[model samples]
Target: MSRWSSSLWIPIVAVAILIGSILTGGRADSDPQGRPVVVYAHPPCPPDLMRYFEEAFADFRQSHPEINLQVLHITGNYEDKIKVMFAGKVAPDVIFMYPTALPAWVELGALRPLNDLLGTNVADYFAAGVRT
Candidate 1:
């Protein structure tokens, strides 16, 4: 089995959130080489959830101001979007997805490993919220 097939979605989300946070001004100072991070969300999130998410993203940006971020809204099948994104090599630096979809991505090496970022015990993450 390949290394990526070992299940490492945490790093993907971490990188995505990190990149998202940076672009939104979470970190005040950053290097010029930092690349812009793109974020995608299914359109029509509940208004209350959208408000909460905006606040959360705002908090994240405040901590990483140096990174750039773009939030794209999608209106079609989530899997289809993911398929095209990966196939076209335009996958976002981070994405929020259902747990069932991860194994396939792991097998495809479509995500980065969290071991290098959060170290071991990454699996200790709670199943609620981000872990799912």
Candidate 2:
């Protein structure tokens, strides 16, 4: 065919392939589960507690093999971590916090309100505790 016809065919074929790929959901990682879910815990959370969390998550993975859980320890300045994350628009899905920080997080709107999930009478929680 003519050079112009050949050139035109190349572009047409490229466009067709591009559109076909888009229609077919293109290429993706083999795992549909996506990135591992992250849970943040305050630094110095006692090795035992950390071990427990890991063990519990391992059990969870055994039953629900699709999801992968990652636990991150905040070594220093937990507040700074939260601040940076909020500013960067990258926030952890879950956090294990000591009770002292809870009020501040609530004021900052950093913590999701669990009132709906927990129902009322949250005051019924322990009057005092190690974490509280």
List clash counts for every candidate, in order. 13, 0
* Residue range 1-132, candidate 1, lDDT tens digits: 567765587788899986776566543232466655546544447778789877877887787676655566666676678767776555666777677888988888887765455557666665453343
The number of residue pairs in model 1 that clash at the backbone is: 13
**Taking the tens digit of each residue's C-alpha lDDT, what string does model 2 give over 18-89?**
777666544332345684454444455678788887788788878766655555667778777866665444
Q: Which stretches of candidate 2 lie over 4 Å from their true place?
A: 1-31, 34-42, 46-49, 115-132
Worst 10 residues of 2 by lDDT: 24-33
TM-score of each: 0.57, 0.52
Model 1 RMSD in Å is 15.7
lDDT of 1 at 127: 47
Model 1, poorest ten-residue lDDT window?
Answer: 22-31
Number of residue pairs clashing in candidate 2, backbone atoms closer than 3 angstroms, sequence gap of 3 or more or interchain: 0
RMSD of each: 15.7, 11.1
Candidate lDDT values, in order: 0.66, 0.65
